[model samples]
Target chain A: MAVTARSRRVKPAGGFELAAWYFMRISGLFLVFLALGHLCIMHLIHNVESINYNFVSDRWTNPQTGYIWRLWDLTMVNLAILHGFNGLRQILEEWINRAKSRVVLRTGIWIFAGALLLLGNYAILMFVKDADYLKNRRDASSDAVTVRADVDRGASSRHPAAVPAFDVLK
Target chain B: MSVYRRGLVSRLVEGLRYGGGAGQWSWLLHRITGLGILLYLVVHIWDTFLVIFSPASYDAIMGFYGGKIHGVEYPLLRWAFRLGELGLFASVVFHAVNGLRVILFDLSPIRAVGAQKELFWAVVALFFFIMIPVTFIVIHALVAEPTPVAAAIVFPRNFVQAFVH
Candidate 1:
């Protein structure tokens, strides 16, 4: 008698899954380092709350300073977008069945992610070129300062300047 | 002490192999990196927004990263910055490659299980493939040690300038 072959079920290997699993642990470790250094420098050491418009204008005015700032900015943008998109992709895989509509949904989501990344990068690049806006800002600030000084010196005090008074029923 | 009972480590390995499908593992990693990146972003933005508020604060921030001084004798800040750069580099590369795996899965015609398995190893391969030069540059930039006396003496001025610069 001939024996029929019995099929055995084989489980899938850890595809990108294992690597991804390891990535989280590794990235988490690094993030702890980056975050602490970042906080210490930004808040604790310098206490960045003292920053203002001229402060930014002066900082960006330096080429090296501008470059470093852009580097950090891009790094943040790229990492955040990639990580968020990948996470969203995982969610889709785990939850949605692999149907046509689901694939389309994922594609659409990825496109949106791409768009957001591009927009963010563009905005950061443009932020450095706002010198005109900065000048206008300076003028406005100076006017405000002058107005405050006048007020402090008693602009509305008893001897008001030969100010024109509005007449009713002229 | 029971012969029939398995240890915790063995149990975890078994669980990952069985309960944790390849896809699940990758998904877990994606979430981890995702959250890490998000956390980094919040602090990054907050710190950077300083450029908008104060120039001195910004300079102080940059200067901290510029170099590290140990008393008046040694500068050790470059090493720290290198370490940070390496971390950021790794994060971006891993996330980007893994993201590609995700994109492929979404686009591929393969079954769910098959896609997961294929992408897992693919991600690993791509990660190292991209990391080679990055690792090299980072290590070269960061690690510092005293030059041998003979070598240092032979080119004292040059060596001193090279290291300092």
Candidate 2:
């Protein structure tokens, strides 16, 4: 009696499946730590509403901020996204039984996931330049001050209790 | 009073006990959680893209995530967020630990169901072992600790001089 894998469709642990199996386990572990740490800081520690552009910008490029946050975020996104796409590829193989369908679907998946990876890296790395964040922060601060002043000068009279404190924060 | 029950629950339990091996269950969980993370990835990418194009829209979405709809009852949303975080944590832990077991068994020659069962148990043990401390640290930081990044980022002399002066 030979040892058999549960999935008959998977061609008895062939090279591609074998490599993917190994990749899933290894990348899964990396994603666990990276993603958990990310969620810990982003969600558990800080309320979701607290994560405004300023907060993200600060984490990304502020000299006063450690580079670890940016690095951690980028690494987590890269690993998790790639790992996820790979896992989906495996699952789709099981679901799409037809060879032609599998090829078409896998090709589409590769293109989409690959494009997403590039776009994600671009948005994360390029948008976080300190100069840009600083400029936005300056503009935001001025806006905040103006809104604060408006409320102080009886802007509240216009809308009884509708002063948008949401707009004006440091 | 005994170790067994006698209804649909017992049938289900017995079925699970006899039905599939550890590999099956582990594979099932891995697929589920992988899909879970992928779903999050799609939304996360869209939201992040919003940051570069429209800060206002990004803020609006963040407000939704944060459950801040201008004076609505919040306990439900808060609990929902906490529960979702916990589920995500559990999924990550299980996927990681069990995934290691899978690789070990796959690489080695041990394919016996008994050994696989033991591997599954080991994975469960490790998951709980790591998660207990990780969960504590996460929740503790959330509640009592000044955000961890603060200390990491702040320059000590600059801070002391500026604040002290």
Candidate 3:
């Protein structure tokens, strides 16, 4: 491949675009682990049916390991959102040639991404389990264990026993 | 003279017809999966945000996922969402694995031209290797509560069953 004058100039002048390219690869490497691990934990290891507000409360409020999860979620949110939006931006740039429309669309994309990032981070950082909810969650957590056991035993009728606990939480 | 502006759909159709090779297909899939995940991420963030501002609403929203809220059951909706989760899982796995292949080609010391096809096939193999067990687990979990006999039919008792149980 011949390196034309334009191609050579890109290295020195591409500045932000160059940085965005490198960021995509680096963050993508990090997310491969972070995201797949998240999927395994949330979807594979634990049934989605088992998740609810109390589940989130329990995970985020645990005394010993909550902070670790918070940090993990924080990093995943920032990296994943930025990498996704940047990739979207690249796609849009390739497809949309008009300069003014491109600028508008790019700004809109960032605004949406920025707002989501802020909201997600705030939810993680500002979460505090109320005493009443915490106490109920503790009780429900034990009930959840029992529900899992029953489900494992092929006792379909026992499944609804888990509903009242979620009802109480609601 | 009127100018005919090419839209994104036309451009995409044209690109599809061009038929470069494995590289083009991989690039197209990456774009698609990336977009799907991003769309889900936006919804996920908003839903989680509800937890902080409205706990009751959060629990109610989760009920839709589980097929019940306040004692009402929507078994069909739950199945639909579970299937959607399976699709999302497939998308995430492919994107992650293919992204790794792209990274290796771009950043690694190895020469990419000779090995690109092999790397792509390796990614496909790994994707299925991961998804097969995962699909079983998800379907098992979905049917376990409603029809234990069917769940058993879907997933025979084995070591993997023991792990999940």
Q: Of the candidates shown, which would achieve the greatest TM-score relative to the real structure?
A: 3
Question: What is candidate 1's lDDT per residue for A1-170, written digit by digit as tens?
Answer: 00110110122247866565555444434444444344323322222222234434544445646666566556656555655566566555644656986778778877977776766576466555356655675566466633211121112333233111101000
Candidate structures ordered by DockQ, highest first? 3, 2, 1
Which stretches of candidate 1 lie above 4 Å from their native place?
Answer: A1-170, B1-18, B66-81, B109-115, B144-165
- Per-residue CA lDDT of model 3 for A104-164, tens digit only, reads 9999999989998899899999998766764674576566634332132222444322222
TM-score of 1: 0.42
lDDT of 1 at A105: 78
True contacts kept of each: 0.06, 0.43, 0.56
TM-score (0 to 1) of chain B for each candidate? 0.63, 0.65, 0.81
Off by over 4 Å in 3: A1-13, A133-170, B1-5, B108-110, B146-165
lDDT of 1 by residue, B122-158 (tens): 8888878757755553454334221112223344654
Worst 10 residues of 1 chain A by lDDT: A1-10
Clashing pairs in 2: none
Docking class of 2: incorrect
Which is the leading candidate under lDDT? Answer: 3
